[model samples]
Target: METIVPNWPAPARVRALSTTRDGGLSQGAFAGLNLGAHVGDEAALVEANRGLLQQAAGIPGRLNWLNQVHGIAVHPVSNEYDGAPEADAACAHEAGLACIVMTADCLPVLLCDRAGTLVAAAHAGWRGLQNGVLEASIKAMGCKPAEILAWLGPAIGPSAFEVGGEVRDAFLAEQAEAVAAFIPSANEGKWLADIYQLARLRLARAGVSAVYGGEHCTFSDRERFYSYRRDGQTGRMASLIWLAE
Candidate 1:
């Protein structure tokens, strides 16, 4: 039931935390609070672990889990929202409506307004970042971008996240400054990309500069995170945000 609370200056009524691979009933590769039901973990185990998370975290309402497809579909979730929608980002303005995204190595960006009236969570893999997931999420908030506070949750670090040239090219096309985020890796024709910086660049472009929590590396921190790149059949940690009652 271990969780990493976001280190940002969000309002007191905003509740959010990024889960770690610790203190759960999951065994083997999916060990320790594996909340993702779509990652080949045992359905019963995943369900039970999710229940443990709800009880331990005291989430006020049902978590709106999205069937993430690495796309930029931004879903607006309410307390009554049901079913796992095919979306990569979710936003909520209602109190107790938790907006959550599960990730192993992909970046989970949790966002809330400074006033705590709106909250959102986005799953940003390379494709999602390159496309416009963060931008879409912020736009869906229906607030001024400057009023949003964002936290970049644990994901694969640049040292561990190598990518093909196409990935680098895609980002550069979106923002020239993205060049600073990529460097030549040892592998020929490959580049190491800092997803955190790329995400920051995207946020900046969308007028969101108040960002935090870009330190943790899931790939390198095997003891606390489940990395799909480090472990193919792995569990998923969740980053969730909700407006407290």
Candidate 2:
């Protein structure tokens, strides 16, 4: 039932939380609080865990879970949903409607405007960040970027996430200053990429200056969070937000 609430100064009605892998019924590798239905955990276990999540968060409304593909697509949600939609991000304008995304090592970003009329959750993996997932989510919210606030949830840290030269090159191609986010690892052409820094840079470029919570390291903290790189067959955590009615 443990959850991490955003520390940013979002409006009072802007409710948001990021779940940890600490309080659910899945066993074995997908041990506790595993909310990802597509990650090979027994369907029933994940469903039950999700129910626990609803009660713990006091959502008071239906959850609109998504089929995150690590792409830039942003789906809009209301109180009703036909099924989990295929999108890396979800935006909500309706009160009591939540926008959520699942993640392990990849970054989970929760966003809302100062007025709190809109909210969004995005799954920002390396590819998706490079391609523009956060920007797309921000654009979908239809708010002035300056009025938007972002909270960075758990993710693989720079010290633990090493990447080949191409990955560094990919980000550099978009913004040369992105080179600052990469430091040459011990491996000849490999680099330790700082996902938090990269995300901050992107948010700043997108005109979002008020950002918070890039402090959690999922790979290192096996107890509180899940990590795909730390464990291949691991559970996933949920980062969700909604407008309180």
Candidate 3:
């Protein structure tokens, strides 16, 4: 299966990869490498796709999946963990344990320290982003925000992510800097919100300056990515990070 390795300067020992919506057995709306199991894709098909991805990435252990409540909850991965936990972000201090986040259009952020000692994955879907998901992740990593490196995975680009007044207000009310990421759209009372820029802005506010890989447009890239906004019943992609043994 095709994958997008994060383009940040993270240490070589910290391996991270984001899977695209290509090369899988899923058919119809969930076509091509759909990794998310909760999106109505067949459980067997998603398991098979996960197998393919793990083998492709040479992941040594099970990937930690989150229920993704779109909140600021961050969990630490442990061997006792069974299935998906109710959290929006996960961090791994142990090597070979993959911290994963599944998304269609919502932002999947991967973060790691320069020393490759800690890694985290966050699912930021505007609400979570505004509610301090990234900041929570950085804090959970137990490292200074400035010492962490962040990479933005595929998401609905600004041109495609139209939002109502409530969405804009949710962010602007907390962060005045977020106003720069919104622009007036053709529809009255709606604005085109740049999820990437907004995420970068939040990271910046948290003192994370080493951000990269925000150019992907899930809405526009039909072949390589899945867009929930473009297809209401589409599948989801996975962005994962882990430290090497």
**Residue runs of model 1 more than 4 Å from their true location after superposition:** none
lDDT of 1 at 76: 92
* TM of each candidate vs. truth: 0.98, 0.98, 0.98
**Number of backbone collisions per candidate:** 0, 1, 0
Which stretch of 10 consecutive residues in model 2 shows the poorest summed lDDT? Answer: 78-87
What C-alpha lDDT values do all the predictions have? 0.92, 0.93, 0.92
Best model per lDDT: 2
- Candidate 3 collision pairs: none
Clashes of 1: 0
Off by over 4 Å in 3: none
Question: How would you encode candidate 1's per-residue C-alpha lDDT over 66-142 as one tens digit per residue?
Answer: 99999999999976677899999999888888888999999999998888899999999999999999999999999
Per-model root-mean-square deviation over C-alphas: 0.8, 0.8, 0.9
Per residue, candidate 2 scores C-alpha lDDT tens digits across 114-230 of 988999999999999999999999999998999999999999999999999999999999998899999999989899999999999999999999999999899999899899999
Residue 143, candidate 1: C-alpha displacement in angstroms = 0.6
Off by over 4 Å in 2: none
Better of 2 and 3 by lDDT: 2
